[model samples]
Target chain A: MDILRLIIAGSVDNGKSTLMGRLLYDSKSVMQDQLEAMEKHSRSQAAGCPDLALLTDGLRAEREQGITIDVAYKYFSTTRRKFILADAPGHVQYTRNMVTGCSNSDLAVIMVDARHGLVEQTNRHTLIASMLGVPHLVVAINKMDLVDYAQERFEQITSEFSKLTQGYTFQTLTFIPMCALQGDNVVQPSTHMPWYQGPTLLRFLEQVEVRRHTNLSEARFPVQYVIRQQTSPDYRGYAGKIISGSYRKGDVVRVLPVGMESVISAVEVGGQKVEEACAPRSVVLRLADSVEVKRGDVIVKPDSLPTTTQELEVMLCWLDNKPLLSGNNYLLQLNSSVVQARVGQVAYRVNVTTLRQEPAPEHVAQNDVVKTTLHTDSPLPHDAYTCLRENGGAILIDKTNLATVGACMIQ
Target chain B: MGTHTLDYLEELESEAIHILREVAGQCERPALLFSGGKDSIVLVHLALKAFRPGTFPFPLLHIDTGHNFQETLDFRDQLVERIGERLIVRHVEDTIQAKALTEPSGRFASRNTLQIHTLLDAIQEFSLDACIGGARRDEEKARAKERVFSVRDAAGQWNPNLQRPELWSTYNGRVQKGQHVRVFPISNWTELDVWEYIQREGIEVPALYFAHEREVVEQQGQLMATSGLFPQGAAAAIRRRVRYRTIGDMTCTAAVPSEAATVAAVIQELLATRVSERGATRLDDQLSEAAMEDRKLKGYF
Candidate 1:
């Protein structure tokens, strides 16, 4: 079965966790003991029904504060597919956590409270999902029970979200009306709203086509480790996951940034020889010639080499509490490559609420997305994030504290 | 057909290999935490696929609780010998004798908690910058919140509140002096996934994982294996065909009555089992709701 990595984003009280819990509960994925524990905890708190939100709020602080603090991942599987759900907090301060969830997700389930319709947090999350190039989106119009499960209210919210979708570029957008608390269109179809005809959220997730969003036409392999036989002096192999495209025996490839070319001698997966290797599979490739490949070096098809440059223009999401200052040095880590980089200039900061570009912000503050230029100490092989996410996406770490400061996408 | 769709097991294997490679590339000195359990066995296999032709860049470290099943120890030795890799074993008894740690004594007394001291000591003794473990997030609640590259302080303590943001697959493996990182390559995998991968790969696991006739005693609603370490008089012993879902200390690792002698049968049994692996087998986790989280904060792996 295919594994779908999805993220659930919504403001506080929109029932993102409840929606997830409903999926697991109705699908019979939640174990009996865990359900018993949740029920007991809910009764102790005098909740009318088993508090589904308590299932995803695992942390003690989150339970006490009744808010999600960081990204919490939950897993479940159906007969057709498996899911890795990332529950991200909706508070504006925790946007970085949402980004962390979106980084590996193929789809974003942005929940909107039917009463509030389209809110600021909804727009911000949609924008971030668009920026991260999440292929699919499911706008869950949650808490329909509170809005009396009215078809007109769902339609109003759906049309408002449709207007907002114009600002984002999601390959597929879907709208589902559900009450996560009462188990409406979330898992079982809502009998309360017979006017609406659509698949349940669970059915949609199982049927959604989670395409492998990699550039299979352009081969890009970043050598992570070199394996050399201790006994056999002639054995040499380069180990890495193919980020894009494929490699076959005798296929001519080039070691990037160093500008050396070689032929693929052999490909091995799980210690056995394979005729071909494709994107996202970890394999060890033996080059025909010893071309001096290192851990951070990228190998690609020689005919379609990426641009090698010392200067990079990137759109960065500042994650650290420390504001970004121009001319301050940080470490830019892309794939396995780490280089000393300094911010050259801040071109513009995105006002996520208004979707406006504020020109030349004084300092990039926490949770601010800014377009900036950076100068690295050494030249590196890279492509724009739009061209190749595996090779283009990066993270900036503080030189002193070593905390992840920013998420970068090469422009 | 020239399609590139990977099965669930294949996808999990690819993700694990990627994580292993990242740890090898980033850390200065790393070691694999092997326990001869099925999970760590899979980890060793992935490591071999990750860097073989060559020996692994790091050694294998095992914190011997001194209360282990002889079968597990023998399996560890044989596997290490077959792979031709270095193995380092540290004993919890050493710390107990040194007066650095006091073993818990009770009806349910086991040296499981004391393994943390031995593990931390081993890390410091070997000066390891990173230690790769085979922990899966689906195993526990706290584990579900753990980052793949979990950073620990000088005291080897885990602060769930203050973890660094891990965006995409880019892990911040930087650590200061006396600090180290714990990398879990199989964090995304589930128990069924592990069993399926083991079956698909035809990997050899310990004999204890399969059903066998063994002398066991009923304690606290769990079937504890009665052996040389535990006399039959400790509890009422009976012969039963059983297998272990997880392998830790013999005192803490319980057995489930099953006739699943083969991997395929074991998979079939697991598909019908309701309780989690730890919930059914581990005796220590029954103490409280936050048992795993509390143990993790105190530096237990």
Candidate 2:
């Protein structure tokens, strides 16, 4: 089954976990024993109702504070689809966790309360989702039941959200009024939501054209492992997963910055010869003849090869307690390749909620997103992160603390 | 899944194979952490599949808890024999006897936590830089934060806040000496994916995961199987129609009431069941929210 990697985001207590729990419960994904346990715990805590929010909110700190502290992953499946739901904490203090959850999501469901209309956190999440290049966005206006299940109330909230998020670029943008507490327009279509003609949240997820998100422009394979026979003579081959595009046997490809073109002699995996490989699948690619290919060596179509640059201008999301100092060398990771990159130019810092750029500061603080320049020791072969989402981005780690201080989307 | 899509099942396999290769090429002296469980069984398959015809680049290492299901031990040995690969086992009981660790206090106490001491000691002993695990992200909340090439300090502690940004297919496997990496090749895979792949590839798994009759004690919601050494009171009783959710020390790992004798039925039940694989059986995780986090920090890959 094709597992849909979905990120659930909304302001605190906007029913993010409740909605997820409802989905799991109604779908029969939660088992009899687990449900019994949840119910038992529920009866011990509250009155009659089992708080579905208890499902993803696993931490005791969260239970005490009644808020999600970290990103909790919940798995549930329908015969039609498997869902990898990453439920992230929405507190501003934990925005870093939220960013991590939305990083690789296929779709982001930003919930809005019908009563509250639009909040700052909702905008921040929507902005982050769009900025991360997540193709689909669903504005789930939850708690329609609170507003007497009014269709007009749903439209008002939807219209208000649209005015602000209109500039956001997304392949699929939808609005579904739901009540996670009451199971309306969540799993089954709500009779109350007859005015809403669109498919329910689950159906929309199943029908969303994921094919449009796949990039088939050209093949880009980053070598993760180099295989060699341990028992025999130096039997060497470069092994890695294909990030994007495809490669087949006998296809001529370039060995990146070395620019040595060679034909793929074999795609040997498990002693069997495979015809080709595509994005995200790891495979061993054999060259017709031996070449000096090792770890971090990228393989791509010679014609569509990304430019190798020493100076990188990227949008950085600073995530650390200490400020980023100029000229400090950090571990720069792009794909499977890791190289030492020095802080070159500290461009103006961009506000998280607003895209407005301010004058460059001497020190970049925690949770600050800045557009900066990176000068690497070696030429980094990659495209603008926007074009090749995979190759174009890099995460900078503080070599000292070993914390991922910043993530960059190469412009 | 799509014309452009790699088969959903095959996609996970390819991703795993890619990661295994990455470890071999990047780390100086890496080892595959084989537990002989279906997850690790799948790992062995992926590693073998990763480097076909040619022998695997790295050695296989097992942290023998001493307390284990005999079926698992048999399968582990059988797998090593079949693949003709070297395996280095460092015993938890031996580690405890060596004064490196201490035995826990109660009937619920398991050597699962003590596996870390042996694992870390083994790493230092072998001078292995990267330890490959079959830990899937979907297994736990803390694991959900894992990077494919997770770097650990000299103490083998994981700092999630400092995880390397894994973008697209690029995995940065570079790490400092003494600061080895913990690579989870199957980080994205779910329990169902493992079963489907096992069925498709016809990979051999320990028979314990399948339905079987066994002696057990239901304590704190986990069906504890009688390992004979624990010396349980009359509370422990034998039961039938049981399958192991996860293969670990027979004492800590629970057996769910399952009739899913075949892999397909297991997959079907897993799809329908709401209790997660670990939630159903993992005794160690029930200890605390930071349980896995603490062990991971200690470099228990």
Return the TM-score for each candidate structure. 0.96, 0.91
Tens-place lDDT digits, model 2, residues A103-190 = 7788999989889888777778887887777889999999898898898888888788888877887887899999888788888999
> Each prediction's Cα RMSD?
2.1, 3.2
The residue ranges of model 2 lying beyond 4 angstroms of the native Cα positions read A36-44, A58-70, A93-95, A230-235, B100-102, B141-153, B157-177, B214-225, B235-241, B269-276, B279-301
Please tell me which predicted candidate would have the highest DockQ against the true structure. 1
Model 2, residue B269: distance off in Å is 4.2
TM-score of chain A of each: 0.95, 0.93
What residue pairs are clashing in model 1? none
Error at A397, model 1, angstroms: 1.1
Candidate 2, CAPRI quality class derived from DockQ:
acceptable
Model 2: per-residue Cα lDDT over B1-301, one tens digit each: 2336755787677767777776776678999898888888888888778876677778889889988888888888988998898888888888898974668866677888788888888888988888899998777656766677788888777755446545445556667778788899888787887898888988878888888887787776668887675647667585767998798887678899988888888888876676778888988877765687667766666
lDDT of 1 by residue, A281-377 (tens): 8999999897788988888997788889999999899988889999999999988888899999898988888888998788889889999999999
